[model samples]
Structures are given as structure tokens and as C-alpha cells.
Target: MLQDLEAKALAGDAEAQALVHLLRLLRRKAYQEARAYAEGFPGELRERLLAGLSLLEEAPDRLEDPLFAAEREVLLGVRAVGEGRREEAEARFQRALALDPYHHRALTNLGNLYLERGEVEAALDLYQRALKLAPDDPLVHENLAALYRKKGDLDRMVAHLKRATRLKMRPPVSLDPLTGKPKRSFRIPLWVWVSLLALLAYLFLKKP
Candidate 1:
């Protein structure tokens, strides 16, 4: 879907270009930047994007707009999560999914809610569905990694953790949260270093 958006944007679709840029910022969790960029557009588009960004603000009130019903539900769901209203949050996320099954954040957040309750299988299913929609979502990968670790699947955990780390631009050699083992970086063999040193020393002596 993102690829399609980018292709359309490149083909001189101004609306597609604007939406693509907005999505890029949103994917990075840059709400402020996305809002500012969205503001540059006019009319309905600006109103809709601004309304969606409002969900990320310090204290957001529910905004009613049929055009953004799904996003509005997601915002309410997130607020419910923060307020310790887990049931309410779940319902909101579910409603958002009913409105738009492809809503990636809704799927991820609902999965998180399930994971918190030790509903591992359900959470795994939701996370996988969310990943199908947004493959580059670092948060989904991180959560999925945690889920895998909880299931005692260390290899899969490490794989997803590494992918999440790379997506978030973190140091590659991070410590394993489960085993306290840091991933080792490759080093030159001792024999190679010794041979290089010996060759350099011989060259210097010959030059003298």
C-alpha cells in the first residue's frame, strides 16, 4: 500500500504526495512534524490530519468527524489505555477495526492489550495481522519479539528483536533482555593481525 502511494505520488498526484509524506512522518512517530506538514494543505485534508494528530496531544478531547471516525476511535482507545480502562480501550480498538480493518495502529494496540493479559496466542495473531499491513513498524516487531520470548522461542525472539533494533536505528549489538547476553560483533582473527604486523615491520626495515 505504501509502495502504491509512493508510485502514485511520483506520477504527479499531489494528494498522494501529501498523504505519502504524512504517512512517512507518522511511521516515525513524529506527530508534531506530521501535524505541521499536514497544516500546509488546505480544507478537508488539513482538518482530517490535524484531527488525527490531536489524538497524540497531551490531553485530547474527542473530535467528531465522520471522515476520521476510525482515527477518532483509536485516539479514544489510547486514552482509555492510559487511564487504565483496559476494557474500554479494547472496545474502542475493536470498533476502529470494524470501521477499517486495515488500521495498523488499532491492530497493534489491541494486540498489546491482549499481550498484557497473558493472551499470548491472540496477541500473536493480531501482531502478525498488523505486520502484514505495516511491515516496517518497529513497535510491532518489538512487541512480537517479546511475545516470542515469552513463549520460550529464543531464536525467533532474537530475530525479531534484531529487526526491531535495525528499524529503530539502535546499536546492533544490544544485550539480550532474556539471557543478558550481548550480541557479539565480528573481530579479525589473531593470526591475520599478527601476519599484518609482521609484513609492516619487514617493509619498514627494508625501506631503512
Candidate 2:
């Protein structure tokens, strides 16, 4: 489960950070906040996330298909961003959304670009729209939470974080700077899983 969550996180699951945030809150005995966060997940968005995970994971397989023109454009946009071609990247992302209004990842990357430029309102708009299009997307949720946090809105931040935590609540790992490998595996014993589940129920369901 740990490995699975790490794979999803490293693959850019936005909500991966939410799980990390939840764990941090839990460790700090911020039970009220954690519960508040988790309660938000029992909604339409949770259903979407549960349903769409497989589709997102398999999406890259279609990159080579002719029908995935918009997806290809998103990749180009991402590459452009990495190359520091800001204008080009923005244009590529915009072109992708023009081709497919529901292009989830493209919206996310574009939102991120806006956020980096300190365009909070534009970034928020894009991120919210992105979440609506891909509610189960971890990265979108995480980004939204970050935006909220930046705005000093802890409640909203925790709400989105909870949504992300529901996606893959596993211990995060640190990479070895030299080898680019995980420094340690979060190997939990079966008994711990059972106990953890019980604790989760208490933490999330027992009203604060």
C-alpha cells in the first residue's frame, strides 16, 4: 500500500500532499482538524476520485493514439514549462484546453503557472475548474489546498487536504539525493493496518 501510494504521488497525484498533511495533523494531535478534513470527502468528489483513478493511470497509454491530440498538447506544454518557455507553455496549455475543455491535467498545469506568477484569482479559477473536471485528481486537490493555505484559510485548506487524503493515505517517503531512490519503505505490519483503520474511524467519524 505504501509503495502504491508513493507511485501515485510521484506520478503527480495532486491529492498525495493531502495525505501527507493529514498525517502531519494526526501526529500533532490535531484530531479536530483531521476529522473536519476527512468529513469533507464523503461527497460526489470522493466518488469521482474512486471511479477515475484507473482511467487517469491508464491515460498515458493513449498518448500515442491519434485521437489524443489535446493530451499531446498538454505534454508539449509541460515540456515547454520545464524548458522555461513560459509564453510557449501557456499557449500550449491554452491550445489544449481549447481543443478539449475538459483537459484536466492541462488546466492544472496552467493553474500552477498562474499561481507561480502570483495571479491568485486566476489560479484559483483554473484550479477550481480543473477539480470540477477531475474531482478525484490528487494534484488538483493538493494545489487547491495550497492556494487556500496561502490565503490563510486553514479550514478550506484542510477540507481539500482531506479529499486528497482519502485518495491514498500512505506514509510518504523521502528520496535519496544521490541515488534518487526512496530512503525507506513505510512497511506496516498487518496489526498496524487494522489498528490504523480503527483509529481512522474514530478520528474521522467521531464528531469533533
Q: How does model 2 score by TM-score?
A: 0.50
Worst 10 residues of 1 by lDDT: 171-180
**Global CA lDDT computed for model 2:** 0.67
Sequence-dependent TM-score of model 1: 0.64
- What TM-score, over all chains together, does every model reach? 0.64, 0.50
With a 3 Å backbone cut-off (N, CA, C), the pairs that clash in candidate 1 are none
Worst 10 residues of 2 by lDDT: 48-57
Tell me the whole-model lDDT of each prediction, alpha carbons only.
0.77, 0.67
Model 2 alpha-carbon drift over 4 Å, by segment? 1-66, 170-208
